[model samples]
Target: MITDDKDFEAKSIIARMQRIDKWPLPPSFLAIIALGYFFTFYDVTDIGFAMPSIAPQFHLTGSESLFLALSIGLIGYVIGSFIIGYLADRYGRYPMLILTMILMALGSFGDAASVNLDMLIVFRFITGLGLGADLNLIPAYIGEFAPAEKRGHLAQITFFLGILGQAVTPFVALAIVPPFYYGWRVLFLIGGLIAVIAVVLRAELPRSPRWLIGHDQIKKADDVVSKFENYLKSNGETLPELKTDDINKINVQTETTRLSFLYLWQKPYRLRMLVFGLWWGLWYIGNYAFLGDAATILSDSGISLASSILFLAIGAIGYPIGAISSWAISDKFERKYIIFVGSILWLIGMLIFGSKANSIALIVGSFIASYSLAFLIGIAYMYTSESYPTRARTSGFAMGDGLGHIGGAIGALFLPLWVAEIGFFGGFAFIGITTLIAGIILVVGGSIATRQQLETISA
Candidate 1:
């Protein structure tokens, strides 16, 4: 918790840093981060398409085996994320990001070469670790660097670019997965290649100055912040004046720790983590329940394989569109409110998809569900990242979201059985209902942080 002792001296670099409202870095720098994130979406999304081909070879005809395969990566994700988050907090964001890409590449390439389902599952665990770490650190990393006013806007843009992976991967899968027995392997190869490339690209990203401050590398932190200040001066743009009163109100946010995720258990941080964790876990439960089997469900319900891919591909357009919408509005309103609206919209869309098996309904409902679900995601990320101080942010998020992933695993595990009992309509409706509950919990329990500096809000 913050206290008077934690306050910085006059001429505080953080106070000076907070005075700027625009990004100090070059606009193009966000590209590589988004590019690295693209692989994550592709790896998660391509599984549904690849499963049809995979099942025949692996003999996963039973629902139990299918669901187990679907849920294993997520189980791995939980473990990997928590470990990586702690490491990132203790080490540094830039180094951890590179490590995450390496792990993902290893997992992807390993999956491509797997001789059996067991081999595939083992490799997938490796992949999940990378994914979990990426998801935890990226939002916190972004929030740490972003000007308070545009934090949400910049994150939404990065996600919008990253989300194109979901938008583009189906077409890639359509071309590869159906024509050959080993076509799915090619998809994995592509994901691996992207990860290798991201390593080189993301090497260019600067470390989070906030993270440096949290670790007591104050001189390094100032040097990093000074780059942005110097950049503004070079452009013939004056830096905003830091007021004495505003500076007095500002407290340097930090805590010294060694492998101490225990900091999260303290009072308001504990409560905040609970709310964010549940929201993260529950949202994934709904998405994994439907998304992992969406194509299969459609195929069984009489939609042709080709048509199912087409519908999914088209509907996937919603990911970027929804991201654009988030970019436009996330900075303007409290993020929890956006999450609430998204849940309602997702519920309506899921209902439409489950109501019947018609083509038009499939197209429209998937579109709505795609974008609305994206709403719960990126906005919730912003909310989660903003809730904690720099020292515990990534690890705290890791523990919270990692445990929440159990809900995802459970949803994927039981979904096939549940669908057998009540069918697709009932399955999707259940997801929608659970989503609504999570949304309500988030809005009621999460902090109100619109337009607030991360230090001020977390304090």
Candidate 2:
């Protein structure tokens, strides 16, 4: 049905874009972004490991105090995500990313130096703000730069690295917390140092070309793309002549529309936003409720604190494994289907773990649950960012993820109460049911987003 000129134009654009993908800069680019995310995860997960030690020092014996300590950061996360997402879209990705890194560094040090519970909570909230912004921005930045064919894989790779930061936290805690007892402060200090290093390294990275084009910075976008083309030429790859028409097409599509928060509530974007928000919120409620309190839950079930940490460390191995699985399968299957299957697996795992709180069941079920959660995370980041156009991509992801933090915060608040009131089985049952509901929602409403161009998907 297409005319010859139109067909030629499509092919030309595809060819030009394909060359950009083949450029050699992606691995290093991904590495820099991944390193930044690594510290974010490290800082967040370290708090869980530190809490057992922190409770005694701060007299945080009551469930209310513990919940306040745990959930306050998520409150900051929600606020920062919404605000930074808008700023990233309006100002730029790189600048906001750098700013967050600085905030994280300062906040981590502040957390390290806290003399009272109030100070600790304030610092944790500040750190959470940076974490929330980074979470929303990193995926958006990567999604904008990566080729459609490899976008899912690259995004998962960064997420995988970040999970590794989390996976190692238990070991780090075991190594430091017991021997020194005061070593919890040292953990925050290390996180601060690493964050400072990431900021320095990330400064060398370039801004997103897709973002540039979306903002009507056509000349800047062209220059960035040209640098990639030149790199390919220097590396001995043959490339087609640059197509002016293809460039114009991108500019035309992206330039006319100015994105706002209200835009997400209209037309096709509304449904997608609703789906993404539900998916993110439900997953966070179940996953954070379980994993965030894994050690405490196990300890309550008669396991020794040391033994629980060991069990948690063993279970944490599933994060990287599941991420690797997501990496391999991401582009091959529809992301919605992947998320649906992961939710089912999570439910099944929670049921198995909840049915019995013995060491063996806890270890095995935790692994399964952790693995399934990782699969969802790897794909969710890609799906959320890609579901919207470049102009609104950061804001869209921020809104969904920010709203999702409410579920996580509430779960953090209530999971301990649930454990105290019922038992481990009852707590797991609650999360399993939540996971099943999420799976059903996805099955009924999720969209397919496999190896599709962001613009085409958004359109």
Model 2, 1-459: lDDT tens digits are 224454344334434664465434646777789888789778768887778778888888777898777878888888888888888888889999998898889889999899889999899899988989999999888887777888898889888988888788878988887578678899889899989998999898787776665565655666676677777788887876676655444422343344567777888888878877887788788866775676776776677777878877788788889889988999898888888888888988888888774778877887888788788877887888888877788888887888988988878778878877887788888888787787777667766677877767877
lDDT of 1 by residue, 340-381 (tens): 999998898889888766888887888899999776687787
Error of 1 at 441 (Å): 0.6
For candidate 2, the 10 contiguous residues with the lowest summed lDDT are: 248-257
Q: Which number leads on TM-score? A: 1
Model 2 steric clash pairs: none
Error of 1 at 47 (Å): 0.9
- Superposed model 1: Cα runs more than 4 Å off: 1-11
Clashes of 2: 0
Name model 2 segments beyond 4 Å from true: 1-15, 23-26, 241-259
User: Model 1 residue 336 lDDT?
Assistant: 93
List lDDT for all candidates, in order: 0.83, 0.79
Cα misplacement distance, residue 287 of candidate 1 (Å): 0.7
TM-score to native of every candidate shown? 0.96, 0.93
